[model samples]
Target: MWNPLDSITVRTFLILIGGTMLSGALVFTLAGTERKNLESHLRTHHAAERIEQAIQLLDSAPQASRQAIAQVYANYGLRVDLAPTVGVVGQAPDSEITQELRQQLGSDRPIEIVDQENKDCPAFTGPHPEDKPHCISVFTALKDGTRIKLDVARHDHPPPPFRGNFMRDLITFMAGLAVFAWIVALMTTRPLRQLARAANALGSNLKHPPLAETPGPREVREASIAFNRMQASIQSYIQERTFMLSAIAHDLQTPLTRLRLRLEKVSDPALRTALVADLTVTQSLVREGLDYAHTITTDEPFELVDIDSLTEALCNDAIDAGSEITFDGTSNTTIWGSPLALRRCISNLMDNAVKYGQFAHVSVQKSAGKALISVIDGGEGIPAHDLEKVFQPFHRLEDSRSRESGGTGLGLTIARIIAERHQGRIILKNMGVAELGLVAVLELPLAPSN
Candidate 1:
């Protein structure tokens, strides 16, 4: 289920490498094409100069030595031959090779480039068709009124030899690019990774320190500044909300206490009992409301807490108080969390089970890098649809659950807040059709060992 490419750094590195390699290949191709074109142009002009020099040499040589001199030039990729009556007919002097020859050999002497195949070539008479070479013939006049034909074959000018292994050089280039891309990916994602860590910590601890305004690129610095500002804003909002709730609870306490005193002095005993009960419910709501707000904004520092020990102590305390509760299972697990907060969380769950189901069964074990604490109650399970809604503050079941039975209804709400602050969660589910009970599973991440 896990993938390395799911990481932002890996994806960024791959994207940089792919994009750079593609761009390099494109540039390399264009450069290679340009180099080939330049080499071809130089070769053409060089071949023309060789032909002009050969002509001058033959023109000045004695007639008897001209044939021998022509044969010597053929060994150097410029095949020269002397012919009478021009063995091959030629085309107009408009081609590139022909124009270069005119520049070197002067316009005074006639010159025509042969465009078609020439039967007079030696390879043309060979038995195999592959032996025949592409030939370019030029017909021109010598200085002494002698006619000569010059032949240049494709084989005479071979392509330049490769200087080195092309593939090896290309691989080396890509490796260098990959190293550079990886460095860039790391540099680019470093700040983002830090920001992500800070954001995650913010979820569990609103008082988490703000991100440092480290010096870097403008965009990264700006993002850091923005994230810090957002963190500060959230902390401020939570503080304001906690203050408002505390103020309201403080104001309600005095009047509620005075009302309780006044109700005790009432004449009608039945009416007074009902009125006092209503006042007690109102007082519990106000107290639990404040407790819920405190859980949200608590600046409780984390410490290593032994989960098994904590649950065992709570179970023993409940047994001492005459509650039908039992604790089982041991994970020997220690986690980084607020001890008091975790105690509050586990106590609330056990209290709910005891109060609603009349009994509580608690257990603890380790699973998949988490410490799972399960508290099951032997009571009619809640409807499937309302399982999640029970965690909402002041939310209670309609039929058998009432203010007198369920208390303030903020137990689960407070418990869930504590679980989430410890980077854990509590899941509620029925015990299934055959087993008529409610199961509460508290899953918390295990503390990393030193």
Candidate 2:
């Protein structure tokens, strides 16, 4: 199973990746649009300049000077075609430019004619026939009365390879951005991983201090502050609970002793017997309470012990007591813990099984750095709802009211506390012929020998 801390770190990394991709995409889109606009403006300006230069050459040339004019147009990487006009009976002008020029010439007085003839000028068009370019066409009557048309077409140049180079550069930039994002995430997440490991250790051992709150970005600093507060709160709560249990146990012992003494003085045999039994029950409860309180207060040094041997001894004692108890499974593994405390926890579980279920069957198993000990029995199982409640101190089942049947009800609670003190856990499950018996499972970490 992945640790909860590792899960948090993975989630944080994914968020960083997602945010970086979104921002990079937006920047790439804006840059591409701006480059296209600038390229289009440059093409338009080049076309306008070509038309102005062609008009100046036409004004200084003769009307029939096709070769000279075509040469000038070709020098500028343009194409030109011209045909002379023949008048009526070779006297009326046949060319489009000559007819338009005659119409302008007949206007009142010799009018200053602005060339206005519209013709398909081939000079401005490119070598590709399909790429029909726009050009300036001018018609004018020269001093000899011969009409001339100047056609100038400019070929549009494709934008240079820089646009493709720019695209490549942008791609490279985005790749670098992605790499930087990963590096940043790795650096930031390192501290978070340390904090998480510390928190997990703290859960298992309250004596350990929290991770230091190092300086970083706002989010990281805030998380560190919150974690520090949580650590202190957990320690405070555990200390308070320990103190409260101790005080309660200490204050109640005197009254319980006095009551037991008074029960011995009753006169009627039957009534006295009943009183004695009640007093005994009260004394047992008080003693169990004191034991639980002590369990929390005593910080006994731990030592390595063979868990199999420990469990076998516990089971053998129950069998000798006339209880139908047996130990099952191999018992050669070793674990580190306070032997006295571990024995108490296992014995409590076995006692509960015998008291409530009539027999106890114990088993021990080792897996994944933990030792699992289970006590199984065949009797009335606990209700699903009340299974958890039975672990609370002083809780008891309504059906098991007899002194011989129901114990002080602190056995399971104490066992759980002991297991937790060793960074372990206890679980209760229903198991029997008809699921009518109880199975108490204790999971304790495997401690290494010192």
Candidate 3:
């Protein structure tokens, strides 16, 4: 199964989300605690003031009517009652609410505040489902010595519940983070992708234009500059090598011609014939070396060429030269390529097949959007191990092929170079044990439609 996390962009986005969410969680927790503390402080301050007002009301009222006034205050979420003496047990802890109450109501008279645990205030009701029932009692003596008990139930104004808004806000946060992370990842990786594409094309097209050093991050711009420099270096090296080979081949021609003439003047006919043959072989090697160098650095422009016609012309020329060769089939396929380069490539394949195998069968056909020109020979096929090795410069199987057959061992090498220049390839394969020949298939992509 394909994984999205395999891509750098997805991984970066996920990492941003994880870190942001973790940081947000810590911030929300701390903020929530501070907010709850503030609300509790405000509620305690307001409760203290109300308790002070209620005590004053009981102190000024007639003794018999004081209970009636206390009962009237019970309806507003506070419980109140009257007694003859202090009725509560247990001491109250010194807390914020107790201190605030003592400060608001003077310390002249005896006053007691007791927290009643595991007790419910039946006279008052709470508004929230999560609210627990609890009560606090404050006992103090009135001016007439009548004891008054004030019960304050636990009431709090909690922050509103999240309900559906929690999910909506959560989704919004993640979606926003994802978009921002995606943009960041894409910006970081685009130049790297462009550099990779240029590197791959450099193998097939060294003379291709250099990458643009567009404005971007410092690291990406630096990478582009480095890549362009490397390309220029490689192109300069290939040009220098090609020029050196061409120069050597051109310089040897005059000496080779003079040697051929001098060998013809030998007194003995057999000796002269042998000397001339040697000179001819040396000239052929020089000429093929020059041709191979030309193939490497040709500046020919591409145009549409009919592959079938080119194959027929080469095959017919070989036949006219008294070589045992046959032409079969037609593809009517056209390709965009240099006509001279394509000719040299196909001629090398035909010459190799006929020279080594003694007879050659050439055919052309279109398959799978590519034009295939196959040349099969009549000679014994080469071993499977040496099939790819033959394409290397100056590589030959000496056991099966003799040097006398006249090859500088650069035919297949030159052919493959031209094929690759035109975005095509040549494959070599043995015909197996049953068939005693080698097959060379030149596969070229078809030209684009009009």
- lDDT (CA) per prediction: 0.83, 0.70, 0.82
* Model 3 regions more than 4 Å off: 1-14, 17-66, 69-73, 84-119, 122-127, 131-151, 155-161, 164-166, 169-173, 265-280, 319-333, 355-389, 398-402, 427-433, 436-443
Clashing pairs in 1: none
Candidate 2 per-residue lDDT, tens place, 1-450, comes to 766545544566667767777876787668667766665454434433443344435546665675687776765645444443521111222244333433544433232222222244453434443254444344444445545444445334444535658788878877787677667767867877878788777765676777677787888888878888988898789778978877887888888788778877888889989887777777777778778877766777888878889999888887888888988886457777889999999999998988888888899988777888999987788889998999898788888635656488788888987888788999999984663499998988776641
User: lDDT by residue for model 1 over 288-343, one digit each (tens)?
Assistant: 88888888877688889899999999999999999999889999889999999999
Residue 16 error for model 3, in Å? 4.0
**Ten contiguous residues with the weakest lDDT in model 3:** 122-131
**Which one is best on TM-score?**
1
TM-score of predicted structure 3: 0.77
Instruction: Compute the lDDT for candidate 2.
Output: 0.70
Residue 165 displacement in candidate 1 (angstroms): 3.4
lDDT of 3 by residue, 26-98 (tens): 8989878988988788867766777788888888887778778877788776777776344655447339878
Candidate that beats the other on TM-score, 2 or 3, i.e. the better one: 3
